[model samples]
Target chain A: MKEHVHHLKDEEVNILLNDLLEQYGYDFTDYSFASVKRRLQRVYINDRFPSFAEFRYRVIRDSTYLTYLMEQITVNVTEMFRDPAFFQALRKQVLPVLATYPFIRIWHAGCSTGEEVYSMAILLQEMNLLHKSVIYATDINESVLEKARKGIFPLAYMQQYSQNYLQSGGQHDFSRYYAANYEYAKFSESLSEKIIFAAHNLVTDRSFNEFQLIICRNVLIYFNKDLQDKVLHLFSESLEQLGFLALGAKETLRFTTVAPLFKPLAQKEKIWRKIAT
Target chain B: MTVSLPRTLVIGGSAGSLDVLLQLLPSLDPACRLAIIIVLHRKSDNETLLSDLLATRSVLPVKEAEEKDLLRPGMVYVAPADYHLLIEPDGTLTLDYSEKVHYSRPSIDVTFSAAAEVFKERLACLLLSGANTDGADGLQMVQAMGGVTAVQDPGEAEVAFMPRHAMTVMQVDRVLKQKEMAEWVMSL
Candidate 1:
């Protein structure tokens, strides 16, 4: 049997969750606890904290550390045209409907680092609806939102993202969208022109506007059933009548309160249509 | 029937392993008081029928792992495709869509390390037939945490690199034959 370094107890994780909610008013209480605990554990262990008590103290005392901790806990892994079929569905099925509207408002709830938001922008630009579309790319983390606003990503990722774009029904040379300088690819200002990056915590923030389509993919999986339902309800209220909603491939509206209001627009693609009330 | 509760038997494999599972699952003790976890490197798209296929073979309830699912004894939880399956200190399973570790999303390393940290001595990890080296360091972590670690005998494995890799990293508790794999898990 080998010696164990400091391992976080189940109760200690609960204490940290409580501390987060009380000290900062960031309500991660309703996130899927298992995943949350695992992610928190990673931060705690990665930083080589000798004891749980000291780690808790650092989080409670240092505001900067708290923000860092918050970022670590949030599942920020996102990619351009992730699950490309979903994007294809957006291009082929949903966008045409949103194109009918004089002005298009697309809310990217929990749009971490804006990869999908940028993906959306590219789609809109291709459809010639970029002139009318305003993409609200909101994330809980201001830092990721900042990155999103810059519209620069690692040049290495461009190849795969380009592949995803082609799979998602992209026609033109994907390189036409961005300029690569050294190791970074800076997207054209034309695509970023219509996007508004803002800090919005799903747990605490209220819907600021209604939209023709709401894309909150892979975001709700981090949330527990109740939080998922609550956020889905928020999406439900924020969507315009006859609007479309898209979720992560694994996420569904079925068994959720919002399910009754939504009919699967592209069931395999996890797109739903909010039946006009 | 009254085996120790809350033990995690985490089995990891990639190629040439499903055949082992198809045979091993049916022989499992129906009332075995353990959370059986299967983390296979699988396809990310639809046709995720591994859990369903396993269910038909075993008497125990088998299902795809979902976000925030509490681990239960007398059941099997199969790691979903395209996501890393991680265990929490509170006995619930969580899924992540983070970047692929070792070029595999449901990387055996990711799940094994998480399960090892959470379960400690109560955890037992078994490495099986695979072509990749994903589970070696993770198996070492399980051993270092005072948990039990096992590998299918490389000689017996259809694809032996995975189990062979685990042996090179740390001293495993058991090097199981395909026939003894089920019995070994039951004994734990």
Candidate 2:
């Protein structure tokens, strides 16, 4: 048994990060150091490692241990129609523009657990565009992507999610989308079929396809400015002309250097359309 | 040049905290070099409104904390709604959308503990009037990290449960009325 250390020193954290990159080929150096360090500290304390040195030693030796650490570092907090107003704006404003295209391609970048992606699908279904749309739901973690593909969310959240759906201008009963089975509500297969779930790391992966709409909400906030700029650039290049991009309510295009490239469709919702090539 | 301040001042409150904040902001010295970070338990939509309100009252610039935003002295940063604002080791702000802790997204404890770790002895955290106990553990963290800790006197606070709860949990450095709190901030 080993005693727990309260926190890791900066150098210890750096060494562990470098070790992770060299051993696993996963680069997290560009992620926000504060968040990366905090998550690493939790991994150390929770696993009851005596010291960061030992923690790093175990992570470097066992691939399984490293995988567990990766899960901890990726923040997966999401909800169905998390901010209903954003979705309402999307339903009223963005979806209509998206309808003008014969085919719609939406990339849910970092689609943790797929709630938002499902929400998008539901909105599209209500708008009579689900059959014509293809949603690419990609996350860096396979475990979460698997969860997203299953489309099972806890029953406890259904009541709240239903409320969110109604507020977001849901055209039908939200309960119509899922079946209750004990503690989990399994969403309909028809909704899940329109989505393609894959493992893609925004940090290392390149754009796989062009999209009319790209949603990377609550994901960029975890990255440092350099990484945010890089990922935003990736999103920009991946979007076609006049494409729509939606970010988390707290996120802003105003802070980034690429601000001039996009024009706002809904400012409060962080919805923008690419105006520059 | 801004004189190097020894510590950053962090203020956290909820519910009735806004009135006290409204009073405190106007009195703060515009040239003060200590960075001020405010976290009020607020509705997610009111974040920009709060920043705008505070900016008009204070002489210093006020802005919502952005991802990886650099911290500068003589400016005020408010935690953006729906995200946990953290002080990174490199003295920048990082936002996290992780599930809310203590039933609050910008949980006072989360921000305080992170700031305590980063600034250590060069930190001062003040727990203000609020209806909940969000700031209690955070003030303890600040104190444990050899930083200064204070609470608004329960008598003067519009809603005192927050500061009163903090008073019982730890040996705080000061329990001052809102006016004295403002004076202390001015002196700092």
The prediction achieving the highest lDDT against the true structure is 1
RMSD in angstroms between candidate 1 and the native structure over all alpha carbons: 3.1
For model 1, state the Cα shift of residue A124 in Å.
Answer: 0.5
TM value for model 1:
0.90
lDDT of 1 at A64: 94
What TM-score applies to chain A of candidate 1?
A: 0.97
Error of 2 at B20 (Å): 2.2
Using DockQ, give the best candidate's number: 2
Q: What is candidate 1's lDDT per residue for A1-277, written digit by digit as tens? A: 3324655667888899999999999888888666787778788878988889999999999999988998889888999998889999999999998888999999999999889988999999999999999999999997788889999999999999999999989998999999999999999999999999999989988999999999998888877778888899899999988999998877888788878898988998999999954
Off by over 4 Å in 2: A1-5, B1-6
> How accurate locally is residue A151 in candidate 1, as Cα lDDT from 0 to 100?
93
**Worst lDDT 10-window in candidate 1 chain B:** B1-10
Q: What would the per-residue lDDT of candidate 1 be over residues B4-97, giving only the tens digit for each residue?
A: 3388899999999999999999988887988999999877765568888999998789999977678998889999889988875567777788
Tens-digit lDDT string for candidate 2 (A1-277):
0121366877888898899889888888988787888788777887888766688789999888776788888998889998889999999999998998999999999998999999999999889999999999999988888889999999999999999999888868899999999999999998988999999999999999999999999888888788888899999999999999999876788878889999998887889999997
